[model samples]
Target: MNLSDYLLAQDGHDWPSLLSDWAEVLPGDFIVWIVNRLGDLVVVLPDGSVHWLDVGNGSLKRVADNREHFVSAIDEGDNANEWLAIPLVDACVASGMALGAGQCYGFKVPPMLGGAYEVSNLEPTSLAVHYGLLGQIHRQTKDLPDGTQIKFVLSP
Candidate 1:
């Protein structure tokens, strides 16, 4: 798999609408500049810093001080691989999983809910649904003790 395989910054993407679900947890104002197959985002904050929004964990990390630096940071060392979820994306493709338009790779059972990060637990899901549900779940569970029991339920 290559950059094209992981890119979610396609033509006509309405990122503001797509990223609205994350407002409760995100740091300040920003624009979703890029996204990977996992729905993880690379956003630019108003202060000119670039940050990575880790979709699964609902966490954010500053990757660079500015857009120019962000470009270098992304290509430096293993930053690209980890930030883009390249290994898992590769595995999913190898396993015949393909992400369609408006879809992303999401954990069937999220890691915060005790699920492994293995590709076997990944599936193609609507990015909006995944982010909306997981954002609420993460917000609710963010302060719970590590071993706390979470009665997870799923329904169609």
Candidate 2:
């Protein structure tokens, strides 16, 4: 899939709230314009800098000074592979997967639970569900040891 295929609507208002649980760790206010295969966000920060919100791991970091730099950075070899995840996207597409406008490809077993970075672990999911679940799960398990056995229970 082409990189442009990943660009979500630029309306920032909806994203922050949809992913609010995962976005609490962000460096302040921002707008989400893109999402990677694992449902990570590419956001333009208040200072005109672009940052990556690794929702799966609940981490954020600046990717470029601005949108222009962000475009170049995303197309530049390694960053392209990591940020765009074309290969994975293509695999998902070929496997008969489809996502709605408000959805993305999300991990069936998130990395925090030892999910492998493979197409077999992906599914089309609403952004709210992906980030909300990951945010809660990661927060609960962030301090646990690698092999620590713990039960993950979701409650209303």
Candidate 3:
């Protein structure tokens, strides 16, 4: 599948619900592994990979953004799967590269009154595409290890 398909497959409304549900099931430390995506808390691995849990279908998609391009889930119109195409944002690539491997970049969504969802882990590829398009780059860092102890922070 491609990145666009993966993003479209996601039920935007489920972000908050998943976050609330995960907060109950996840240990406090594990919360740090969770990456906020516009209020949706996605589990991110140390390799800069992300897991999107479909609350509606109880399914999961593991995604990795390597700056150059992305692959996404495909709907075959049956019990099958195909691949979707998505391009990366250049800025996102620059940011991801700056952040180094095993790290992700975060983007802020303008505040919505009384809404819980605000920021999201910018898809590395998407960010790359954005950055590449605009020829901009953002500051980033790398420190944590795979399965390293983590703490939930409002900002990365």
Q: Which candidate is the best by TM-score?
A: 1
- Candidate 2 residue 134 C-alpha distance from true site, Å: 1.0
Q: Write the per-residue lDDT of candidate 1 for residues 1-156, one digit (tens) a residue.
A: 467777775467666666677777786578777888888888888999998988788788888999999888878999989888888888898999988878889888887787777898999998878888777778889899889998756697
Separate clash counts for every candidate:
0, 0, 24
* Candidate 1 all-Cα RMSD: 1.9
Give the Cα-based TM-score of candidate 1 against the true structure. 0.90
Q: Considering TM-score, which of the candidate structures 1 and 3 is the better prediction for this target?
A: 1
Residues 46-129 of candidate 2 have per-residue lDDT tens digits of 889988877766677888999999877877768877776677887887898887776788998887687877889888887778
**TM-score to true structure, per model:** 0.90, 0.84, 0.23
> Candidate 2, after superposition: displacement of residue 7 in Å?
3.5
Span of 10 residues, lowest total lDDT, candidate 3: 109-118
Segments of candidate 1 deviating more than 4 angstroms: 153-156
Q: What digit string (tens of lDDT, one per residue) describes model 3 on residues 27-82? A: 33321233222212345445555454322122346543421222232232421221
Candidates 2 and 3 compared by TM-score, better number:
2
lDDT of 2 at 38: 64
